[model samples]
Target: MPRTAAPPRTADLQARPYKPGDKVVAVVDLPGVPEGTTGRIAVADGLTWRRYWVRFDNGEMLGHVDQHALVRARDWDAFRHARELERAEAERAAETSAEADTDAGGATAVAAGGATVNGVAVPAHLLARSKAARERLGA
Candidate 1:
């Protein structure tokens, strides 16, 4: 099989826009540093391959951390709020679409043999198995 080339890393000059003493929160887990760990930028290094040296509150001093792994502490709460609103809107839109489909002449109506998922027939046994799995997993 032929392998596809990885996406090129573009020069993101804005990556390490943080200055020394700027507060940031980890977006991903680092070695000995858990996600959401608040830290201060000790040093912002590199140009094309921007990285940071952070002094975390949990006593982890990590080096070469990229901007993708951190978010400005001031903006974290606003970012999370925006993301939650987007998700709730998406769920409401999906529910509205599903209801419209059901009301429009039984497009989503189930047949006698089994349940339908997105209008596709699912066997009764498979549906039962899925229900059992969900119950077992407490989902």
Candidate 2:
């Protein structure tokens, strides 16, 4: 049997993160507009059904344009920079969490001449007082 290609997954599709005032180029022709027309995103409003209103250079203003039909004019450079920043932030967060775990683990160890109570050191005198008080209260 001949093998068939799998349908594209949602993650395989590039996300359209369009915003107002973004310069874009249409990938498909629309009413009164041709492909490769330069435009500015006038407004972006939608929740589940995302769309954009674009004012093309050819004096055509199209509304309810599907985000997939347009691409940012500088998507390559802009997306690369954004991804690099996200990666750097993630690395910094991981390092910070690792440092915090190490610090907490070290803190739980009993220090010299002191007993730990809830991971914090209590002086010998304080421990003795607490023992006596506990005995008096029968607790």
Candidate 3:
């Protein structure tokens, strides 16, 4: 059998000392963590005195988070990319309403649809359907 020597450790592979300007990953650990219940990991821009002031992937400015709950991010670049994708997906979903409206020549119209309004097919125009929807027997 042949023996191979172990590779030298690299600075990049080591956990960096916590720094105010350094990027970190926020982790939430429970008192009694159980299997399958994972803590949250988020990218933090920087740290404050005893906490971190960073923006979450959801764009909420989490002004302060416990320093003990944060760790040096394993891959900052990948984290940033994932966060961006998450934000973009959220924005897209928010802008694109699941409800459909009949837009005809820049104007909305009322029409029958698979959706039910007062047990009847909903109109294509969301607004019109809503207004007429109030006329339901028990609505």
Candidate 4:
């Protein structure tokens, strides 16, 4: 009997991180893109290009962007505060779960404290802070 290989998972989730409701900034325009601004990123993804997507706050329009051209996205203060709150909540959960498995708390903490960038572990707080600070400054 021949052995079968697993299917490849080609998700671009490794590219950029954006929540369904989060606002983003557009960095560039690809003529190949459908119809959106070059330098400006719209918040919603409804009007986005190939792999790039964003939706504005008012929920008016969705922009399509090229996944490759997406150089940067604006991270704001509100997003920071929200993350801090999220971390606190996660820590609390870890504490509770620690009783079931002591090792679990440490593992959770380690995972929560950092995020992966191109498969490299980077401090989540730092990324959050920089984006938040830049957003605050923009406002």
Candidate 5:
């Protein structure tokens, strides 16, 4: 048997604290990015420096942002609280609408081939699709 040489090692991989879906804020402007822009971590690579990809609030996707270039989003706690409030509001609205629909003598109203519950005009099918999308995105 012939001896084989070992493959050359590249950069050492390190584990990053942030993961996909984590909210982050840009600490330094790079190229088109400006400081203070909020974004979400789309991809995180621990193998190389500046290997993360960020999708900014303005719809710009930038890659290779180093860990030091970003920080956890400012007001992260407030953002979470706001989302919780929104979720609660949506739930309450849905409940109230259902109650109203039931109070209308159990009459099922259909408009343009879509069922109407309360005064909300959105189609049931569309609402289901939107709910599915939100669940998939973990939003």
Candidate 6:
């Protein structure tokens, strides 16, 4: 007698953009996570509303994440830009602190209320104003 081959898996009727082996990022926290995280698409299901099986960097596998809750991982250029802006803000805050110390005859002067960036205190109103300006400028 001849050996028989296994049957092929069933194909989904619905169409979707993503497929297995695609990289993805979580726009919102996955189940049991404290916050949102990124993952790889281990399985893609076009038939269901909950469409992806995501494998996170930490070795955890999420069985079902909706397509809307995830985006292509390559689309994080804006996030990278925001991180660069945050680093620049921290550096500026440190420089301002040093200048204030020098002007105050080496005495430490604590800001009453402000936004702290990278452990440096920046004036809250200034930070807020700058943020508004950036938003207006579409940066």
TM-score of each: 0.50, 0.44, 0.27, 0.26, 0.40, 0.40
Question: Candidate 5 — which pairs collide?
Answer: none
lDDT of 1 at 30: 97
The deviation in Å at residue 41 for candidate 2 is 0.4
Q: List the residue pairs that clash in candidate 1.
A: none
lDDT of 5 by residue, 17-60 (tens): 67899888776687678877889999988755556899999888
Once model 1 is optimally superposed onto the true structure by TM-score, how far is the C-alpha of residue 35 displaced, in angstroms?
1.4
Q: Ten consecutive residues with minimal summed lDDT in candidate 6?
A: 7-16
- Model 4 C-alpha RMSD vs. true structure (Å) is 19.9
lDDT of 2 by residue, 60-123 (tens): 9999999777777766345445546667878999999877755664464445445655445566
Over 4 Å off, model 6: 1-16, 34-36, 48-50, 78-139
28-103, model 6: which lDDT tens digit per residue? 5766542346678898776656588888876678876777766667654444454456678789999998887565
What lDDT does model 4 reach?
0.47
**Reference-based TM-score, model 3:** 0.27
Off by over 4 Å in 5: 1-16, 48-50, 75-139
Task: List the lowest-lDDT window of 10 residues for candidate 5.
Answer: 7-16
Please provide, for model 1 over 114-133, each residue's C-alpha lDDT reduced to its tens digit, 9 standing for 90 to 100: 66665555667787898999
Choose 1 or 2, whichever is better by TM-score: 1
Clashing pairs in 6: none
Better lDDT candidate (2, 3) = 2
lDDT of each: 0.76, 0.74, 0.46, 0.47, 0.68, 0.64
Model 2 vs. true fold: TM: 0.44
User: Which scores better on TM-score, 1 or 3?
Assistant: 1
